[model samples]
Target: MRQQLASTFESLKVRNYRLFASGQVVSLVGRWMQIIAIDWLVLEMSGDSGTALGFVMAIQFLPVLMLSLVGGKLADRYDKRRLLLVANIMWLILSTMLATMVVSGLATLWHIFVFAGLLGVVNALETPVRQSFVSEMVEPKLLPNALALSAATFNAARIIGPAVAGGLIALFGSGTVIAINAVAYLAPLVCLLMMASDQLHRAKTKPTDTRISEGLRYTARRPDLLLPLALMFVIGGLGFNFPITLALLAKTVFNTGPETFGILTTMLAAGALVGALASSKRRERPSSHVVMGAAAMFGILEIVVAFSPTFWAACLLLLPTGFFMIYVAQAANQRVQLGVAPQFRGRVMALYILVFLGSTPVFAPLIGWLGEVVGPRSGLWIGGVAGLLAAITAFAVRCRKRDVQISVNLRPRPQVRLIEPERPTPAEQPA
Candidate 1:
């Protein structure tokens, strides 16, 4: 069991990955704690306005939509380790500022918005760079495992962070939780500084003549990447708006408080953690078919969860919802990363992040509005339908490509096999 457990977590076998993952576990938990606090703060300050929460969320990702391409280029041009260090430092500073404002009782709605926007700027640079940086921590063969483990750690933090934040908020306030998060940024910064420079899988230096549109063009020409990205755009835009959806559900649907909200979030994270761990155990990379299938499952689950008659029932359904969600998510991530060449990884990943996150700004307000005007269930239903449509579209594209390949290869070619005569020479027969 011990050996099996170690093998299952093979990415941690790498010294660099071990250090990085450990720090990230701590940092991401803190990050999630901050997120819960911020959302609660917004709701409190804005009089439970879902639109206000949506806007804050949108502002946080707008920069990623605008500047991720440039960030990807910078990731390719600079050392990832050093770039991450700088980004972490920026995050630490920003977290501190937010903490101070809140603790001092001077934080306003505008202050939160401004801080979110600035953090969005930091994330634009950090997301793509960090995506590409994962490859440097482990061997190429272990990339799938590493990526799965990375997702697992993130979801694990999701479990701990909100639970901790909810308790902290009850005992103290949002300010205290935010302050705790400010201290949490130290883990990743220290870990990055401790890594050996020579161990990193550095990209070859590229000529300065490369254009910013290079990654866009590269991704545009490949159906494998283009299809998954389209799927991500649809699902990520509407389906992944959990912060907004869950918060509204807790408030409007269940009429629950922060503690119950935290429990629901933890439930989703628990399922996601399970899915990610299962994904990590696979030795081979997942196919697009697998990705689409998982996505379809996710869509179906979302629709089911939307109609749950009670909060407990809804939470029960969210377990499998979270499971398939991570399966689809990690599968798409693995497919894209494995398909792209190393040189373009940064830029390609930027596009992936764009679809994966940036599109949220475009759809979040709409989702929030739907939740308010129609009902909280409306957002889930729309997201589910969108996910189903995206999956069906991807399936059609995959079939079309396969049919085209079959037709192209149907023409007969001359047989090149050498005949082995019964009357072969004795020397040849013996050999």
Candidate 2:
């Protein structure tokens, strides 16, 4: 078991990846803290409007849609370590400013919204760079492990950060949580600077390039990637998004406060972390079969969550729901990134981010409206059913595509005369 765990962590053997992962762990925790604090603060400040919550999420995800291509282009063109450092520094400055304003009681809903939009812009620059950076520091075989570890650590932060944020919000306020997040950005900046160039392996950047469109062309041809991307539009955009559901579950179903909501979120994160670890332990890339199965299971479990009679059960269900959901997510990401070549990885990953997150705005309002109409439970029904159908379709498509091939053969033909008798080909052909 110990050896198994060590092998799973083989990616961390690289000093550069180790530093990046460690700092990201710290930074992700801060980010999660801010996420929870902001959600709770919004609920309190605005009387728990579902539309407002969705709108906030829309602002954050909106930029990811518009700039993912540009972000992808940048990731392929520039030094990713430097890009990440700059984004973190920007976040630090913005977070500090927000903290000061909130602490001084000068913060308003519009203030939070505007700052949230700015953070969205920062992530537009950061997400693709961060996603592509791992390959620079690790071998091809080690990449799945690296991505899995990244997801696991990120999920672990989700578990701890929200719970801690809840307590901090209870003890102090959202301002302190924001301040802590600002300070935490320094950890990643330092890690980025400390990463050794010797440990890096960047793809050759073209001094003059038109290859951004080439990445899109490649993805356009790959069914394995295309199908997963399409399903992500369904699952991530419609079924898998948790923010709108979180507000409804907290305010309406559970009748709980921010503290309880945070606990539920933490439990969900714990489940997702477990899923990440389990996926990382596998020796091979999970097939589309695995990805679809996890997605289907996630949808079913979500229904179980909707029908749960009490807050504790709902909290418990969140773990399994998150576990399966993230299992599918990481599997899909690993397949898409690894299946593409190093030269095209940045744009490929950018599309992955866009497909995975870009549709949230379109679906969030629709789902929020469902919550308002038939209730939160009904909204889960839509999510569960749609997600299951998407997964099943993806699975079938991949299975059908297996064993496909085109035959080619080269054989010497009897010398044939051109514009002459078949027997008189000595002069006409290579007799």
Candidate 3:
């Protein structure tokens, strides 16, 4: 057991990764806290209008869809640590502004929207740089372990942060929680400054390319990269709007407040943490089949949660749902990063981010509107169906490609004998 545990956490042995990962854990928890607080705050300000909440969510991610290509180019051209430091400082400033507004009783719905939009801009710059930075922090062979451990850290924070935020919101209001998140941004900033810059494996600098469409062109030439990204677009865009769906579930369907909402998110995060740990322990790289299977399971579980008769039952259902969600997402993440060339890692990963997160702007509001119209359960059904269909489509394409290869092989008539070459005698070898 001890051996297994050590292997799962082996990435921490790298001094740079350890510093980055440790800082991320603290920063992510605070980020999640702010996320929950924002959701609840929107609900409070908008009188539980799912549409309003969706609008807030959409504005936050819209910039990624629009400017992430540029962000990716910048990541490739510049130092990731420096970029991350700037982003963190921006977040700290924004969070402070948000807290001040809320505390001073001047915050309105538009204030939340503006803050979310500005934060989204920071994310557009931060995410792809951070994603690609993992490769530089550890050896190529340990990349999978490092990525998995990062996911584990993220989900573990998801588990604790929302629950704590829920309690804090109940006690101190959203302003105080936002203030705490503002303070949390300093952890990563300090960690970045403390990192041994000389020890980092910096990517070879490439000539700057101002053409934002180059990344899209690169992805178009590689089906391996394209397929996983398509799956991500579907699952991420349509199926991963849990903030809207889960928030509605707590406020509308369950008739509960921040406390119960936190519990629900915490349950989801617990399952995600478990899944991430399992991914970290795997000896082999996760294949596309694994990603598809996890996506299918994620969809099915969302359907189950949709029909759950009680809030507790729904919470229980989300545990497995969360597990498969991260499994699919992280598996796809590993698949892309491992296959991509170093020169294109930033740009390809930016496209990956574009699909995985940029799509959120288009879908969040739709999901929210669905919840507002037919019912909150309707959004879950839509999301689940999208996931299920994405898995099926990927599988069908894989089988078709296999069938085409089999047909060609069957027509070939090579009758070569399969024999091992004679081993060289010991005396025949060069001294």
Leading candidate by lDDT: 3
lDDT of 1 at 57: 93
Pairs that collide, model 1: none
lDDT of 3 by residue, 200-256 (tens): 888666646735577678678777777789999999988889899999999899899
Expressed as tens digits, the lDDT of each residue in 1-431 for candidate 2 is 89987998888889999999889999999999998888777777778777677778788888989998788888888888888888999999999999999999999999999998899989987898899998899877788898999999899899989889989999999999999999999999998889898768875554356366887887887776787788788889877667678657877787877777788888889999999998787656567677788889988998788788888888888888989888989988887876776777788899998988888877877787778777877667788888888988776665344422233444464453323233442211100
Tens digits of lDDT, candidate 1, 1-431: 99778877999888899889988999999999999999989989998888898899999999989999888898778888899999989999999999999999999999999999998999998999988899988888899889999999999999899989888987888988988888998999999988988887776565464467877787877777887888898999989888888888988899988887788888888899999988888766677788899889899888887888899998898899889888899999988888888878888898999989989999998998888888988888789889998898888776554542222233486434433444543321100
Cα error of candidate 1 at position 219, Å: 1.1
On the 0 to 100 scale, the lDDT of residue 108 in model 3 is 97
Q: Residue 48's C-alpha lDDT in candidate 1?
A: 84
Candidate closest to the true structure, highest TM-score:
3
lDDT of 3: 0.89
Where's the lowest-lDDT run of ten residues in candidate 2? 422-431
Per-model TM-score versus the true fold: 0.92, 0.90, 0.92
Give model 1's TM-score versus the native structure. 0.92
